[model samples]
Target: MGMSYRRYLYGERVYGCSKCKTHLATIHSMISRAFNGQHGRAYLFESVVNIVEGEPCDRPMTTGNHTVRDIYCIKCNTTLGWKYDKAYEVSQRYKEGKFILERNLLVDVQ
Candidate 1:
């Protein structure tokens, strides 16, 4: 395995992995906070960093069926949330290529 390097984010409000404090996303990138996850509330982000994406698989969600991959914190390898690879619903197409991070798994690092 190659050596892994994590990126540090600088923003007015930064969100990170609660377990390891590794930067994930910033407030500027957040699209919505009205989402829900397995653990509870989740936030949708336009982009994210310092994480690893697992294999994509089909999953049925409240909105619709989607192909998603579980995302893990690079520093601690904790399951933070998932990334949308393909959205099956036309109305949910906007979520493709985006990421979701569980609120309970995040910590404000600003």
Candidate 2:
């Protein structure tokens, strides 16, 4: 394997992994706040960094079934959330290629 480089995000509001405080995403990249995760409330993000994704698997969610891959913090290996690969419901298709970061597992690093 090659060396892995972590990206740092600079902005007014930065969300990071609670365990390692690694930069994940900024407020400007946030898509929505009314989402739920395994831990509790979550936020949907247009993009995120400094994380690794696991294999994609089909999971049923409140909106519908989706093919998602669990995302983990690259610095601390903490499971932060998941990334939507495919949405089964047309109404939920907007979430595909987006990411979810649990509020309970995040910290305001900025």
Model 2 scores a C-alpha lDDT of 0.96
Q: Which candidate's TM-score is highest?
A: 2
Question: Residue 77 in candidate 1 has what lDDT?
Answer: 93
lDDT of all the models against the reference?
0.96, 0.96
In model 1, which residue pairs have backbone atoms overlapping below 3 Å? none
Off-target runs (Cα >4 Å) in candidate 2 are none
Q: Give the per-residue lDDT digits (tens) of candidate 2, residues 7-60.
A: 999999999999989999999999999999998999999999999999999999
Least accurate 10 contiguous residues by lDDT in model 2: 101-110
Name the TM-score of candidate 2.
0.98
Q: Taking the tens digit of each residue's C-alpha lDDT, what string does model 1 give over 9-110?
A: 997999999998999999999999999999999999999999999999999999989999999998889999999999999999999999999999999996
Q: What is the lDDT, from 0 to 100, of the residue 79 in candidate 2?
A: 99
